[model samples]
Target: MAVVDVALAGRSYRVRVGAGLLDVAHCEAHAFIEPYGMRSIPIVADANAKRLLGERLQASFRSAGHAIDWYEVTPGEGSKSWAELERLTDWLLTRGITRSDHVFALGGGVVGDLVGFACAILKRGCGFVQLPTTLLAQVDSSVGGKTAINASAGKNLIGAFHQPSLVLADTSCLATLPPREMRAGLAEVFKYGLLGDAEFFARVDESSEAILACDDGVLETTIAHCVGMKARIVAEDERETKDARALLNLGHTFGHALEAETGFGDRLLHGEAVALGMVLAARFSARRDLISLADAENVADALARAGLPTEISALGLDCDGAALADHMRHDKKAGGGTIPFILLRKLGEAYVARDVSLADVAAFMDEQLQAH
Candidate 1:
């Protein structure tokens, strides 16, 4: 088992990563909850995760004489909405969960975001634990404090930065993840390298197949590497006030718009949209002369080789560039009416480019669409 500690002022936590960490979580939870007088825990899990390993987790807890009140939601982006939030909060309140008790998010990113946000606003802020089951959640949202629900206007427009009390990422849990989701999560792993670590990216890109094949050593190393990078960034800029944390949103500006355009449905998963958005950002960088065209193609090729989307042409959205750009206005990065996009100066370096005009983005997207 590998343990990485996120040292945040006033709120530090450990991110435990390894195979078969799920059983360990049960033991730890028993120690924490039993003496604390919290006999039952409200576990908000997604359908898929529950079907796969829910019984095992529950049985482990049950063996220790812990009661689990399981609340399940259907998987996917659609679950992150105002209606679901309201329902979950109401259910949790009915279960008598207070700030003193901890709520558990035991699924992928959607469940983490939803449960975290619910805990954030519930009773003026309750504590929650993250049990990230999918690869995307393990690598990205589970460790970050950025909890949110989708608004009608955009993706993640409404959110709060409420750090989790604990994060348990079991690589073994990823065995149950669908192929598409596994590939989508790899896009985020690619983001870590593209944004900051050239050497790491090179090694992973060279070993893409082995990593995709779920080699335990490579999988653990890849997840730990991404988590390490994120832990440092979050420590430096937990709220993204500095440019350090914002760099994490390497392709989010365009990607969120793509998600909104698709109504946050199965048409485009968050990681898939992000993979496509990274290509767009890379191309836009090339257009701005910040990076060479060959560099942009290289980024696109790496994403494609990982079985992720790298183009906007195949999405077949009926919207135009102007419409796509309009959705970006509601982005969390938009401040003072000027949107900031994370563009790369080179393969391993990224900086916030806020001066890029929306008209320009729309036009470039149109060009990309027409080309396809």
Candidate 2:
């Protein structure tokens, strides 16, 4: 197993990545819940994951002598809402879940975020474990402590910074993910390179095929590397108090806008929105003379090669730049009446800039839409 440690002073934890890790009794999973001395454990999972990987996790904890309760949330972004959160919390309460018990998030990013946020407020903050089953969750959402539920205003508008005690990413579970979901997850994996690490970007460029083919070795190595990068950053800045953690939101500002504009439905998956956001960020950097157009094209080309969406026009999205800009205003990074963006200086280097004018962003969005 490949282990990456997220050093958060008092809240440090380990992210274990490996194929078939989920089937090996999951001692780590059991320990995360048991260490808290929680009275009962709630395993929150998507319906599909419940059958695929959740069952194994349940059995693993059961064998470890812990009482396990299970809850199934519908799959997709629609599941992250106040209504769903309230319902899940009610179910937990009905099951006699106490503040002493930890909730186990047993699916992808959505599951992790929702469950983690629910645990954060339930009984003044219960603990939770992250058993991310998707690549996106494994590398991005699962590692970071940013847990949230979506509101009608925007994506992740109502959320909290609740860290998980353990993050277990079993590569084998990814095998059952749909092709589109897999491709969506790659957007986040690619972000680690685009935001910083040109060499990692090049490595991903070379290993794109191997990754898509789901080669166990390549997948394990890729996940470990991404997790390592995130762990170090999270350790340095558990919250976005400093710009250190904001770097992780390289393309998220724009990505979240796109997601919100589409109502966080299937119109564009989070990864698809992120992929396009990266392309837009790169292009905007070049348009502003911060980076060469060639570099921007390289970013787009790399995303294209990875089978990710490289343009907004192709998505058949109904909104225009003005609408997208409106959505940007609702982004979490929007503070003091300005949306902070993490723009690239070049491949493998990104900097947060609040000075980016909305007009400039709008013009770039218009150009991208026209190009498509």
Candidate 3:
């Protein structure tokens, strides 16, 4: 088992990465969860996850003498909505959850975001544990404490920064993930390398096959490295008050717009959009002469080889560049009449550029959309 400490000043937590961390047969899952002091565990999982892993999870808790009161959420981005949030919060209230009682979010990013946000506002903030069952959640969303749901305005606009008490990423869960979902998660895996760790990026590129094959050693190591990088960044800037945390948004700005254009559904998974968004960021940086064209291609090549879309043109959107840029205007990051972009100075080097022109971005996107 590998542990990465997210050493937030007073509220530090550990992210445990390994196979069977969630299995009570190992006793580790129950041990870490027992201290929370809830006799009957309140767990919220997506419907699909419940169908697949729920029995095992329930048995694990049962073996530790804790009964589970499970809440099932519908799967997909739609679950991260106003209606769902209201429903989940009501359910948690009915369960009599207290600030001291930790709620367990046992599924992928959607389940985590929904439960985390519910815990954030439930009685003005409660504790929760992340049992992230997906690679994207394990390596990125689960550790950061950025809980959010989609609003009429934009994605994650309605959310909060409430860190979890603990995060258990069971690598064994990846075996059940669809190939597309796994590939989408790889975009985030690639982001860590592209934004700050060149060596990690190269390692991912080199071991892409093993990773796709779910090589346990490689997958666990990869997850730990990404979590370690995120832990350092979160500890440094937990509130995005500084540039360190903002660096984690390397491809999010552009990616969110693409997601918005696609209606935030299966049409483009969050990770897939980030993959293309990162490619666009690299290419845009090259256009601005911040990075070389060759470097931009290398970035695209890495993602493309991993089975992610590297071109905006491939999405087949009816709207043009200006429309996509308009979606970004509603982004939560937009302030002071301009949006900040996370552009590459070079591969493994990203910096915020607040001076970015939406019009210029529209034109650049237009060119790409027209490209074959």
Cα-based RMSD of candidate 3: 1.4
Model 3 clash pairs are none
Deviation (Å) of 369 in candidate 3: 0.5
Candidates in order have lDDT scores of 0.89, 0.85, 0.89
TM-score of 2: 0.95
Q: Whose lDDT is greatest here?
A: 3
Model 1 lDDT per residue over 216-288, tens place: 7788888999999999999999999989999999998889999999889999999999899899999999999
Candidate 2 wrongly placed segments (more than 4 Å):
33-40, 65-67
Ranking, TM-score, top scorer first: 1, 3, 2
lDDT per residue (tens digit) for residues 1-372 in model 2:
899988887888888899877665347665556654545677888899998876677667667676767789899998999999999989988877777676788899999999999999999898888889888998899987898988888989899999998888888888889988999999898999988788998998889888877888999999999999998888888878889889999888888888887779888899999998888888888887899999999999998998998988776677778878888888887788888999988889999998988877877777777785
TM-score per model over all chains? 0.98, 0.95, 0.97
Q: All predictions: root-mean-square deviation over Cα?
A: 1.2, 1.8, 1.4
Better of 1 and 2 by TM-score: 1
lDDT of 2 at 287: 86
